[model samples]
Target: MTTRTDLLVVGAGPYAYAAAAYARDRGIDTHVVGIPMAFWRDQMPADMYLRSGPDWHLDANGEHTFEAFFEDRGLDPGEHDPISIGVFLDHTEWFAQRKGLAPDPRLVVDLTRPNGTFVATMADGDAIEADRVVAAPGVGYFAQRPDWHDQLPAARCTHTSDLVSFDDLAGARVAVIGGRQSAYEWAALLCDHGAERVDVVHRHDVPEFAKVSWTFVDEYVDQTLAHRGWWRHLPAEERAAIGRRFWEVGRLTLEHWLVPRLTPGVVHRHPGCAVTEAGSEGASIGLALTDGTGLEVDHVVLACGYRPDLARVPYLAGVLDRVAVTDGFPDLTEGFETTLDGLYVIGFAATRDFGPFYGFTKGCPSAARIVVDEMLR
Candidate 1:
């Protein structure tokens, strides 16, 4: 049987939930599909902490914000400064219930538009037809693999996304690549899991652990909603300046809370370095660094982060040609619609056109409002 909906949301993360809630509230008959918060539950470490605070949430109307969740549950916001993944997931469930949004929990195996209507094939062979489709894919599909990924035996290599639990690595020596927050956080988690030794190698200087403010992103998100093509219309230098500001706060600064978890001698930091060469060496992987250093580890974790590529999305393979892409990101309109009519892409993939804030939960409410309003128009 074919399920029909006016608006089909192809994910159940923060972006999908918000968009669906908003669309339904506007009488769009929205139907959502995907495991709710699957990426956060499976890809992230079991005991991981989020860099974002309780203020970030997925309520498009802003009536049931995370702050509201805290108040309703009588949980003090200060007690959860750096929120845990578990708590955030609970809040998402509460928000969904309050909005009467229950995702189908089925994966969209394939997506294509035929005869002026969108058809989505579910993993269980069900088909859903809709007038419009809003896909809010998470970042797991876009994980960036380094050049040396294939050099070593596959058993000794893993991406951070797939290495959520470190129990198996308790007695192993591991090497983590990338200088970003994930790299450092994973290192700390590995230490907590009893990894004998962890070597963190990166091409950039080690980032400082300090508290930083994200209030600066509010203005940009507001501008994105108030003015069409706001981010793309900015002057070249202005865009560059904004990018720099984000890099400084989001990348150059890590949460001071991670400092204690990264034990001194157990987790070594090799900054200003790159893996020039890597190969299997009997029981371990041998790595040659750009700084003329060498290391041997039982396993390697690639925390190089994600770069959105529409073609890499498995479900979009059938209709990918219909979508225009810049670099790897979709060429979206100011309202987050892709080149394909009535189709929208949100979350991390929308960052290129909407600005970096769209890649975080902070942009959820605004993005939901913008996309739904555009759909109505």
Candidate 2:
């Protein structure tokens, strides 16, 4: 069977909720799909805290904020410096409810433009024809499992994105790979979950977490909106370097919060080292490191994070061949619209073009405003 809407929002996270709410309020018939906050609720550690501050929220018209959510729930949000994961999930659900957003709890298996309009085929064979589509599958689509990872036993090494819960891993020693937020965050969580030991292995000799101002984040979004031609003219490497610099501050600064749980005895971090080789060690995972030392662990977790490669988006497989790309990311216009008319990418997929803001909750309102303005145009 087939249905129709003016807009199809493919993911139900912060980006999709904000986009659909704004579009719908503007009188656009918007249909949202995918489970709400699926990534945070399912994949992230149960007790993980948000790396961002209280201002980060999924408000469509900027009327609702995490502060507002907390106020309504009879709590002073200011009391909690960094919100807990569970509290963030509650806030997201409350925001969705307030926006009247009930995303179709099914996956869009395939999307194609066989005719003039776009058709989204659902997992259950239902179809939705739309004049426009907003794709925001979040970071899960862009997870980076390195090629060298295959050297380790599949059961031994797992991507951080795939980790649902550490309940069963109690008392098991684990090694978390990477130097950034995910690696450090997971190492702390594993420790909290009663893991016997958690070792962080990274290639950098000294992990740096230079301070970056929040004003810089706002500047990125504002500058992109003000002068996109100049923004796009910048080389991809230069843009990535700036974004990486901004991103480093968040991850590294956030790591300080985990230090209480990650101490000298509870957690050990090995810097300037890379896993050169790996195999099964009797009944455990064995790793040969670049430091010329061997280590054994019950399991290994790769917190390498995601790359903005469009190839990682599964539902877009049917349509990817036609869109123009800039350095493996979707090439977007000033309005966040893809090469295809009436179609847009708002989340991580739009980061490279829209700047660093689009990848975080704080950028949702700006991103939604840009896309809605374009769709109205």
Write down the lDDT of every candidate, Cα atoms only.
0.91, 0.81
Candidate maximizing TM-score: 1
Best by lDDT: 1
Poorest 10 consecutive residues by lDDT, candidate 1: 53-62
RMSD of 1: 1.0
Q: Give a tens-digit lDDT track for model 2, residues 45-148.
A: 78777767667777656687887888799987666756788888888899888888888998999999888799999999999999889998789878888677
TM-score of 1: 0.98
Off by over 4 Å in 2: 206-213, 228-230, 233-241
What alpha-carbon RMSD in Å does predicted model 2 have with respect to the real structure?
2.2
Each model's number of backbone clashes? 0, 0
In model 1, pairs of residues that clash are none
